[model samples]
Target: MTSSTPLRIGVMGAHSTGKSLLMRRIEMELHGQGIPVARTGNLGRRAALVPLPKMQHHTLASTTWVIATGIADEIAAWARLEKGPVQVVLADRACWDALAYFRAALEWRQQTAPRAEREALHQLAHAHGRTYDLLLATVLDPDVPVESKHDYDPRYRTLVDRHTHDFLREENIRHVRVTSDPASQELAIEHALQLCMTEAPA
Candidate 1:
C-alpha cells in the first residue's frame, strides 16, 4: 500500500435511497471549493452490461465483479491525480453494497452462500473499506414513496437495507447514517464538505 491516497467518500444503501443525490450534493460542494472530484457510479448497470446477474438474481460471480470493479474505479479516480489534480473521489455504491444485495437475494430464495465464499468476500469488502476517508449509508424508510417507474420489490429492498447495516456492524466499520429527513441529508453533505476541505492536498 502507498503511504498516501486520495480522499474518498463512499455512499451505500438499497435501491431507491438517495445515494446518488447525496453524492451529487457533495460533488457540487467540492467543486465550489475548487477541488477536482471524480465520482464512480452505476455499477449495477455496468455489471448488467457484462451480462452478470444483478438485483434479485445476484450471484457470487456478479457480486465479486461489482466489488472488484468498484475498487478499481476508485483507484482509477485517484490515479487521475497523476494526470491532473483530482483530489476527492465519490463512490455512489461502496464495495460492500453488492454483498448486501447478494446476501439478501439468497435469503429471499431461502438459500445460504457457502461459509467460505461469504467470508472471503466479506474480507475483501472490509479491507477496501479501510481506505475510505468517509462513508455515508442511507437508511431505508418504507413510507417514503419511490418513483412510479421503478418496479422495486418492497421485501427485497428492505432485506438489502437490513443487510447493509448488518455488514457495517459485523465489520465494525464507522460511518454516518443518513435518513430521508432533510436534516440528516444536510448533515451528511456538511460532513463530506468538511472532510474534503480539511483533508484535500495543500
Candidate 2:
C-alpha cells in the first residue's frame, strides 16, 4: 500500500459466510508477500482473554457495546502495528456489520429501537467506519453451505443476507465482494491487495 500507516480493513458478510476463513487466508497470503498483517477476531475469540462488557445479551445496548469493543480492539492493534512496520490491520468484522446485524435482529424479533437511538448508532458506526481503508465482503453461496450452530436455518441467514446487501448498497461503501469459490476467493484476494495498496495511511 502507498500509505505508510497500516491499512485497516474490514472483512464482512452475513452470518456464516466464512469471513474468518477468508480473514485467516488473507493474513497468511499477506504475510507470505511480506506485508505485515494483524487481524482482530470475532466479537469474542480475538479478545477472549480481555474481558468485555456482557455482549451475549444481544440487546441494542449490548450490540452497541460490541461495536465499541470492536473499534477499540482495532485501534489498539493499529497502534501496535505502527510501532513495528505492519502494513495492514485486517479485522474480522466492522462496525457496519454490527449495525446490520443489530437492525436485522431487532427486525427479526419484531422489536423496534427508538429512531433517535438507532440513528445515533448508525452515525457512530459510520464515523468509526471511515477508519477502514478497504472492506472485503463475502457473498453467500447457497451451493456451498457451511455448518452453523446458531444460524442453521436458511431463512435467518437469508434475512441477514438481505439486510447486509441492502445496507451496503445504501451506503455505497467501497468494497470487494468475494464469491464462495476458490477461483473467486483468489481473485478477491488480488482485488483486496490492489485496494489495500491504494490506501494512504494517516
Top-lDDT structure, candidate number: 1
- Residue range 53-152, candidate 2, lDDT tens digits: 3222246666677688888877777677344656788888878887777766777667888899888888878888976877878887878757655535
Alpha-carbon local distance difference test for all models: 0.89, 0.73
> Where is model 2 more than 4 Å wrong at Cα?
1-4, 44-57, 81-83, 148-151, 197-202
Q: Give the CA lDDT, 0 to 100, for residue 101 in model 1.
A: 95
Model 2's TM-score against the true structure: 0.84
Q: Candidate 2 at residue 43, lDDT? A: 86
TM-score of each: 0.95, 0.84
Candidate 1, 148: how far from true, in Å? 1.7
**lDDT tens digits, residues 22-131, model 1?**
99999988889988889999898898899998788898999899999999999887776455767888999999788889999999888988999998888888789788
How many times do residue backbones clash in model 2?
2
Question: What's the residue-level lDDT of 63 in candidate 1?
Answer: 88
